[model samples]
Each structure stands twice: as C-alpha cells, then as structure tokens.
Target chain A: MTLLEDILLLGLIVTAVAAPLCKRLMATVIVYMSFGLLMAVLWVLLESPDLAVTEAAVGVGVTTILFFLTLRRIHELKGTKDE
Target chain B: MSKKESAWTRFAAWVNGEHEPAESRLFSMGMGPRKERRPEITLPKREEKQRLHGFLSWYPVASAVIGVILVGILLATVLAMPSFGQVENPTNNEVPAHYLQHTREETGASNAVAGMILNYRGFDTFGESCVLFLAVSCVFILLLRDENNTSQKDLEQAQRREQRRKRRQDVILQEAARLLSPFILLFGAYMLLGGHHSPGGGFSGGAVLGGALILYASAFGQDAIRRFFNEKVYNTVRVIGLMLYAVLFGYYIFTGANGLENHIPLDYGGLILPIDIAVGLVVACTMYGFYAMFTRGEL
Candidate 1:
C-alpha cells in the first residue's frame, strides 16, 4: 500500500475499534459511519468500484439511517438523558 | 523436501477444483488426506480444565499477546499477496476473460456484471432473492407487535403520542422530502429497468427505491404511503417478485432456455430485466419492512 492508503487503513481500523468502545451511543454511531466511509475508500483503492458502491449504499446509507431511526425511537421513549 | 511440495500443492487449492458439496465430500471422499488421525492428547478432567481456563483468563495481557500475534500473521499474509492488476495474479486467469469477451453476445446484456449475475450465475441470483424475502419475513416476525394482546387504552395513548410526535417534527424537512421523493423513485426505476445496459443493477436500484420509500414515509408520515402500499399490498408485491424469479427458473429447467425445439419461439428470450426487477422488489421491501417494523414495532 501507498503511504496514503496505509494511513487511511489505519484510520479505518481505529474507527472500527473506537466505535464499540465509545462511551456515548451517538458517538459510537458516528464512528461506525466513519468506518463505513473509510471502508468504501479502501474498496475503491483495491480497484473494486462495485464493492465501493455497495459499501457506500448499504453500509453507510441504509445502515446509518437504521441506526439513527433506532436512536430516535429510543429518544422518543426514554426522553434522552443520552445513553 | 516433500513438505515443500505438499505446501505448494495446498497453496494452489483452487487449481484442484474442490467444488463438491459438503455432503458429497463427506460421503465420497472419506476425508481423503485427512483420514490420518491427529496426534492424540489426553484431556484434563472438567474441574482441572475450568481451573486452568480461569487462570488463563485472569490476565488481559495474554489476550493482547494473542491479538498481536494474529495481527502479525495477517500482516505477513497481506504482504505476501501479489500486487494489484499484476499479469501473474491467479484472478487474472481465463474465467474473467471469458465472461468479459462473450457476455454481450451470450446474454444480450452490454454490462458484463449484470449479464453475469442474471445469466451465467442466474441461480445464485435466485438464491439471493429468496434470502432477501426471508430477511423481510424474519424482521416482520421479530418486530411486528401482537395487536390483540395490547389493551385498548394503551393503544389509544400510543396513537395520541405518535400524532403529537408527528406534529412536532419539522415541516420544512417534510416539504423537501415531498419535493425530492418522486425524482428518487423515478431514478430508482430507471436504474432497475435499465440495469442491463448500465452500472446500476437490482441491488443498487433496490437500495435507491428503499431510500425513496423511507424518505417519502418520513416526510408524509407512514399513514400517507400506508394508504397505498399497506402491509397486504406490500406482501403481495414481495411475494409476486419472489414467485416470478422462481417461476422463471422453473420454466428454464422444464422447457430449457430456447423452448422445446431448441429455438426461440416467442419474445421471451432474456429474463434479465424481469429478474432484476424481481430482486429489486424483494430488496426494496426488505429495507422498507425492516424500517417500518423496527421503528414503529409493527407494519
């Protein structure tokens, strides 16, 4: 990998690990989004445009929306003291 | 040494074409080279094993060490891989060439990937359709609330709260969603129906459709879309999509692709467009259903 690719990959790994470990639920969700974006970039770097498209669509788009929807539902019920 | 030869042989595993089903392998092959028993080691008693396990689990340092070792091994494997787009790479072989060269002529689809999914590996696409159908079913079963079990008073309270919540949501966002929703659905349809000649296919088009539906529902409230595409209507669409794919394949099996006399009888030669739409429908429903059931706990 080039220096740029290597740095991006390291950032990707950090985001992946940090997502679950993040204290705040919202922060965790944002970190997961960051991880997905990074993964899409990595897929592009690996010369798999189709995979990059899929990762962006499903991983970043649909999944993040799902997470946000769930979070909203939780906020509706619990009145958000922020988990 | 023979060990080196054996290692090289094992490394080129795909060259051996070990593509048989698991059951067939177990029955016919009789474990082949693995028939030789592994060296036996005596097992400790349960109490002793538990004590040892507890002792090992006491230190997080051991876990860290194991993780580092695993990373190191994986890094080595990555480093040893051939450079991307190299001529000598195993993936640079004949199979991809065959697909790329003959895809248009063989399948009537200009897009190689689309042709491959809907033609060459058509059955795999059929399986994917079923999987998407099953996914929606699972989510429905898990999240759909049992209406009869809930008290009438509780239901009224929930409905009142939902309406209050809906009123509180931003109208500007809803207006924007309203403006954009039709365009989104139109684009998704174009993607799905025109997939054979373009980059977009069922998966991407379905994702777009799902996004459009979600956007529309969020903007107009579930009641708006629900009026037209209620649960019964959505279920029918989903089932029809899956059934068409299944029936298409069944017809292919029964009469063959070119019909009984091995010649094109009617204009029903390529099923790529229909199959793509079918898969797209299932996927779109899956995404929409999961959202509906999860967020509202019913659909």
Candidate 2:
C-alpha cells in the first residue's frame, strides 16, 4: 500500500508540474485532471473515501466539463480556429 | 459636460487597465486638472526597451527559482511536522472519541463522518449548500440568455450551431449515453439515500447525477433536456431544494438550542435522509445548471 501511495504521489507531482508547462490548453486541462485523479487515489490511501469520491466527482468530472466548455466557448477548440 | 473624475471612477479605470498618467500624485490629491500631461524624467526609449527585453528574458529563470524555493520551504515545513496518524497526535482528542462513541446513538448514522457533518456540525454543511446555491444563481445572472440580454446576431449564431449539431450528431456518444446513464443515475441515488450508512453522501451523489445529466445533454442536445427540465422546472427545483434544507435545519437548530425535545426521531437517522436529499438536489441542479448555462447560456 505504501509503495502504491508513493507511486501515486510521484504521479501527482508530475501531473501538477506538467499541467502548467503544457503548450496546448486542452493538454493542460487533461494533465490537471490526471492530477485530480491521482489526488483522489491518495485520499483513498489516507482512508478518506468521502473525500476521494468528492475529489473524483468534482475535481475530475465537473471541473473537466467546465474547462472543456470554456475552451469551446472561447473558440479554442480545434477546427473552431478557422471560424 | 465633462464627467467628474472621482476616485471610484479612477480606480475603476485602473482596474480596467486603461492608460493612466505615469505620475498621478497631482490628480490623486484632487489639486490639478485630470487631463493635463506633464513631461517627466525618463530613460531613453531604446535603452528602456533593451532593459525591458533583458528583464523579460530572465523572467522565466527567476520564476523557476522562486517556484523551487517555495516548494522547498513547503516540503521543509511538512517534514518538520509530526508524522501522520499518530496516537499521541493533537488530532487524537477527546472530541473525536466522543463523536465516535455517541454518533450512532445520537444521530443514528452508521457513518460517523456523515453524522458529524449532518448533525453535530450541520451549519457547516448548510453553509456549503448555500454556497452552491449562490454559485448557480450567480452563473444564472451572468450567463442566462433572454431577449433583453441576447442580441439578434447571437440568437442566429446559436440557431446555426444547434442546426449544425443536429446534422452531425455523434451516434456513438448517444448510444453510450443511453447504455450508461441509467446505471449512473441509479448509483447516484444509492449514494444519496445510503449516505447515513456509507462513504457516499449528498455532494458526491449529486455531482454524479449532474455528470450523468451533462452526458445526456451533450449527446442529445438542448431540446430533449428542455422537454422535461425547462427554465421553470429548473428554477423551481433549485429554489425549493435550498429552501427545504434551510427550513428543516433551522427548525432542528431552534429546537435543540431552546432545550426542547425534538419531535423528529434521530433513531432512524430522521433528519439525515431529508437533509442529504435536499443537498443532493441543490448540488445536482447547480452542476447541471453550470453546464447548461456555459454551453448554451440558458437552462
């Protein structure tokens, strides 16, 4: 369990750093989402399943949709650039 | 007629990033005319531009060093703190013990965390619900489309987009949504209703429900969702959910504070179910409302 946690923690750090450094907004959002997912796993490891559930649902799910919508609305999505 | 330039208007202009005088002491002290331009000492423009370029070139390295230092400081702080989940830790107080021992009996919730949040520290949860409610209300105010706010060109553009979406709908998304939404909704209902006894709760469950709603909406378009959850129904559900939780929790607090024997029984987790449902309703609506408003500027 500790080993798995360590791996997840490392992944979290990587995703956190990569998110801001990503060139494309979509990639940044995706990396940020992976960070959320890793944090959810860490929450479960910490024995806070409630937090894990909320993190997965809110941090990963709703937040990603909102980000995508914002991207689309701003005409940042692919193929919308020409328009 | 020249507009009177008060501090408020000047501050607003500053916030909007409008061009301002390099030295505004005279204008700020209200002693000089606002429009007067004064020549002041300055660096040669070419030299200043070179200096700016030099600073800009070093900005990334400076920021990276600062980031590393900040991270090191935070890590050091965490390392200096005691290790996690120690028996003698400050968090292992009598308060947690008391909650653990009495939660099941007092709140009839098998889940101590749920009992604590929904019963003992209910006002915190109430405040959270209010925040979600307020968030959706703010989004509605900012994004809701109507004849007053939406221009004719915007309406036509939206119509064109809708038609385009209809013409090139993704069959796979619609089919997958049809296959998966029922199970997702069922799981959400289970989480909401079983919150008193399990790890799941109102917020998580409502978010799941909202996710399912968004998926269906994305697959099928606005017309299908509007058939059932039009503006009127959405408003009613959102408002009523918050009101229900507020009234019920307020009654509970009033009775408890006044030292009266509450009419509701805590044995069967009397208030937990209703409160959870109310919270779930608010959250689900808030999530869906955000998605709908963002996508179409209406619900």
Candidate 3:
C-alpha cells in the first residue's frame, strides 16, 4: 500500500483503541464520531458522495447524539457522579 | 582361553551395570520412555451395554425418518425444476417527466414525492399517521398508568432518588443541555417543514425532535419539561392532529375536491392546507409521546 493509505490505517487503529479506553462516555462518543467522520471521508475519496453525506449525517450526527443521550440516561439511573 | 572369556564377560557386565530389567517386550513396545500405552478397546457388556443399545436403536429410527423426508423434498425439487424465466416484470405506463410536471403545476410542491403523498394519495398518509398516533397512545397508556393520581411531588421524589443513586452532576449537564437543545429543536423543525423539497421527511424529522427532548430531559430533568408539555395535552394534540388529517382526507375522497391542491392565487405560490399542519402536529406530538414513555422508565 501507499504511504498515505498506511498512515490512515494506523490512525484508524489508534482511534479504535483510544475510543474503548476513554473513561468518559462523551469523550468515547466523540472518538467514535471521529472514526465515522473519517470513514465518510474515505467514502468520498472512493467517489460516492451520497453515501458520504448519509454517513456524516445519520451515522455521525444522529447516532452519536443518540449514544450521548442514552449514556446520560444510564448515568441518571445509576446515580453515579461524573469523574 | 577360560580366563580371557571371563575378563570379556566382566567388561560387558560393567558396561551394563545398574540398569533395571526391561518389562515384557509387548509392554516395552507399547509403553516406551516418553510414550503412553494405547487405551484398551473393550466391547460394552451387561447394563452399560443395554443403555448404549437403547440410544442407538431409537436415534437411528428418528434420524432415518427425518433424513428420508429431507431427501424426498430435495429429489422433488430437483425433478420439478420450476422455471423462473417465465416471470414478467410489471411496467407503469405513465411518463414520469410529464406526471412530475403536471403534479408540480397543480400542487405547486417542489418535490413530486411529497406532492403525491400529501395531495394525491392523502388517504394513505392519513392512515399511516393514524397508525403512528395509535402506537404512541398505546405506549403512553402503558407508561402513564395511574396517571391522574400520581402527584408531581411523588414524581419529583422518585426523580430525586434515582438521581441520588446515580450520583450524576445535574447542574453542569443541565447548563450544557440548555445551551444545545434549542439549536437541535430548530434544526428538527427546519427538516420537518422543508421536507416537501428536501431529503428530510416526517419520520426522520420527528425523530430529531424527539431526540432533542430526550437530550433535554437527560441534561436537566423530566419534571421541568413535563410541566410545559404535559402528558394529557400531548395526547390531546396527537388525537386532534390525527382527526384533522382524517377529516381532510375524507373531504377529498367524498367531495372530489383535492385537500392539498395548491391553488396559487397570489404571491404565496403554494398554499399549505390544514393537512400539512396536521401532519406536523401529529409528528411533534407522537415524538414527544415516545420521549415521555422512554424517560418515564415504563418501557
């Protein structure tokens, strides 16, 4: 593979590792969203703008917000103070 | 010669000194230095034998029947060889461009799909909205059991208990949520109203709005939001909206006058009917209903 492809693969791997390790739920969500955004850019690079738009809006935007909301609800139920 | 032979024998004995006698040849061959002997294979006998026999006899009978049936089906399918080549693709005769042009001119909706759904096939949309309303009502009833008697103070105490157990910092999240929720609501409304000309539609737009409310509740508290948009009022809005949509659809079906037929007399270009307004209301109410059911922890 080219240097650029190798670099992107490395970045993706780092993000994947970091997302799970992040202690805060919101930070984890943001990391996951960044992964999605990067994936959308990859889709755009592959010449499918429609899929890119859908991934950006539905995958990153709406889904991330949903995750954040769910996390908040869980925290509220458990009555645990944020670190 | 006898002395020389005795000396050679003594030398051989010394070379093999302190070595233990090897076991039987068969045992030695099977159980070598680092190797385990093969386990003995014995035929089952007596009571143990009967159990094996019982399992073997019954299992084969059941397996044989299933195997035979599956084989028969496979053979029949192979022999019948149903042809898929004879299947015909259905075609619509209406020219898409012409239909689109006519719909745009008649309804003045920039989007053809919206025009078709809201104006031409409005009955179907009404039914769909009614179904949504019914689902929301069912969810609301299930969640808000003993609705009239449950005092606000009781709900507040419950919320406080849940909050304490969770140990969440409500103030900080609440502040952030207060800042962000308005923008989310605005975006959702934009998607709902601009749906006639854009990619966003009722379902997605309603979800966005519902998501915004859920965010608000999570950040601040359900009690504060509930005070503004009460369960009964939301339910009423949902019912009224569905009824309005049904009435408009029935009007078109009975009177032959189109309900959302955009008659642009003046500068407004396309005039929206009570139908679109009803749809927006239903969407908003049903979304809120879902949020209430979800946040209230009933399911």
Candidate 4:
C-alpha cells in the first residue's frame, strides 16, 4: 500500500482502539462513526464503491442513530432507577 | 455589503469580542457552580470484590500472556497471506475470473457485486435478508408494548411526555424536512432502481429511505407517521416482502430446474429485480422498525 493508504489504515485502527477506551458511551459512538467513515474510504481506495456506499449509508447512518436512541433509553432506565 | 456577508461579518465581530454574548448582557453570571453537585450513583461496593478476589490477581498477567500468544498466531497467519493483487494467488483463481468474465452475458448486470448478490449467490443474500427480518422480529418480540397492560406508572409517564412535547422545536425541522424529504426519497429510489447498473442496491437504498422516514417522523412527530403507517401497515409490508422471496424462490426451484414443465421462457434476470425489491422492502422496514421500537415501545 501507498503512504496515504497506510495512514488511513492507521487512523482506522486508532479510532477502533479509542472507541472502547472512551469513558462516556456517546463518545464511543462518535468514535465508532468516524471508524465507519474511515472504513468506507478504505473500501473506495480498494475500488469497491458498492461496499463503500453500503458502509456509509447503513453502518454510519442507520447504526449511529440506533446507538444514539439506545443510549437515550439507557439514560431513561438509569433515571427510573434513581427515582 | 451583501446581506449574507454582513450577517457573517457581524457574527465574526461578536466572536472577536466586538459585542458580549446576549446572556452576559441579560444576566450577571458567576464562574462558580450555582449549586452543590450531587454524587452520581455508582455500582454499590465494587471494592468488596477486590477483597473477595484478592488485590493482586494473576488473571491480568495470564490474560496478557494469552493475548500475546494469540496476537502472534494472528500475525503469522497475516504474514502467510499472498501479496496483494498478485495473479498467482489462490484468490485470483478460476471461479472469480469466470464470474467477472461472463457476469454481463449471464446476469445482465453491469455491477458484478450486484449480479453476484442478486443472481449467482442469491440464496446467501436471501439468508441475509432473513437475518435482518429475524433481528426486527426479535426486537418486536422483546420490546413491543402490550396494549392491555397499561399501568398507572405508564399513564403518568405519558402525561409527563405530553407536557415535554410542547417545548419540542418542530417548526424549523418540519420546514427543513419539507424541503429535503422529496429529494431524499428520489435519491433512495434511484439507488434501488439503478442498482443493477451502478454501485448501489437493496440495503443501501433501503437505508436511505429508512433514514428519510426517521427524519420525517422526528420532524413531524409520531402521530403524523401513525396517521398513515401504523403498526399493522408496517408489519404487513415487511412480511409480504419476506414471503414473496420465499414463495417465488420455492416455485423457481420446482418449475425452473425441471425441464418437463416450463412456465416462463426464462430471461436469466427475471427474478433478480423482484428479489432486489423484496430485500429492499424488508431492509427498509427493519431499519425503520428498529428505530420506532427502540424509541417508543409502541409502534
């Protein structure tokens, strides 16, 4: 791979590591979103635009929203427990 | 100066300290906390576990050793891989070459991936569709609210939500969605229909459509969505899509393979379009269904 591709892969790896290391779950979700975006770019670089499109649309868009919604529900559960 | 430019100029000047923020002008705010911070609720007595399990556990060291060994094995496997894009590699063998060579003539799709998913390896794609459907079904079974089980607590929660609903900023979002929804829907349709010729298909296009519905519901409220797409409608659409794939494929198995009885003089691409649409519908429903079920237990 070229230097650019190597850098992209490195960034992808860093994001994957950083996501689980994040204390706040929401921060982890944001890191995961960037990871998805990076993977999509890698797919494009590999010349599979179809997989890139699916990764961007489904992995980033739908999955992120679902995670956010689940996070909200978790907070609600915690609130109920406190009350 | 142009109106938009002047607006930006004023914003820049304010940020540059030409003007104080509006809140500062309105009220004198303090730098310190206004109230004592409440202690957050934490897991009760995790320190007890340290005593029970011992302070200096050997698990971490053992895990690290195992992890290193596993990583070494993984690295060895990676090093064993043939160099990228090498023609002599096993991956660049006959089967893929045949697929690439005759995809146009046999499958009639310009996009090889699309043809592969919809035509050649269609059963695997069907299984994936079933998996998504299964995910939705599992979500429904676990999280769906029972109509008859209305408690006093739920009633109170509903009332509290009603009070909160008044403060929701819907007008601006509604206006924006009105401007964008049509284009988003059109793009989704393009992705679905042009999938055969290009770099899109059922899953991606369905996600786009589902995302649009999510935006619309968020802007216009659940009741607005319920006016048309209720629980029954939602269930019916997805089930129909799943059933269509199952039934058609089963029929094709008996009628298609057997030459003794020929039904449709076969265009190889005949079932691909319908199957693609079926997968698209199921996927779109799964996406939207997950959002709806998770956010509000009611459909």
Give me the candidate number with maximum DockQ.
2
Ranking by TM-score: 2, 4, 1, 3
lDDT tens digits by residue: candidate 3, A45-80: 666544564566556765676575477667832444
- What is the model-wide C-alpha lDDT for candidate 3? 0.66
lDDT per prediction? Answer: 0.78, 0.88, 0.66, 0.80
Mind giving the per-residue lDDT tens digits that candidate 3 earns over B1-299?
99999777776664445232344353344644776778997756886789888999999899889978998999899877754334432333355556577766665566666677776777777777888788877776566645454788867866676677468556777787889889988877776666566544454565666667767766666666777766667767777877887776675566544533332331221433456657867866666666556545432
lDDT of 2 by residue, B1-299 (tens): 23556766877777555747558774465655577678887999999999999999999999999989999999999998988889998889998998899787777788998888888888999999999999999898789897667899999988988998999999999999999988989999999999999988889999999988999999999799899988899889888988999899898888772224677786656788888999999999999999999999987
Candidate 4 positional error at B101, Å: 2.0
Inter-residue clash pairs, candidate 3: A78-B166, A79-B165, A79-B166, A79-B167, A80-B166, A80-B167, A81-B167
Candidate topping TM-score: 2
> What's model 1's interface RMSD, roughly to a tenth of an angstrom?
1.5
Give the per-residue lDDT of model 4 (tens digit) for A13-35: 89988998898888999999999
The positional error of residue B110 in candidate 2, measured at the CA in angstroms, is 0.7
User: Residues B102-156, candidate 4, lDDT per residue (tens digit)?
Assistant: 7766666777888788767777888999999999999987877775456788767
TM-score of candidate 2 chain A against the true chain A: 0.95
Q: Which candidate ranks first by lDDT, i.e. highest?
A: 2
Per-candidate TM equals 0.75, 0.87, 0.53, 0.77
Instruction: Give the CAPRI rating of model 3.
Output: incorrect
- Tens digit per residue, CA lDDT, model 1, A17-80: 8987888788898899999999989988887655776677678878988988888767842464
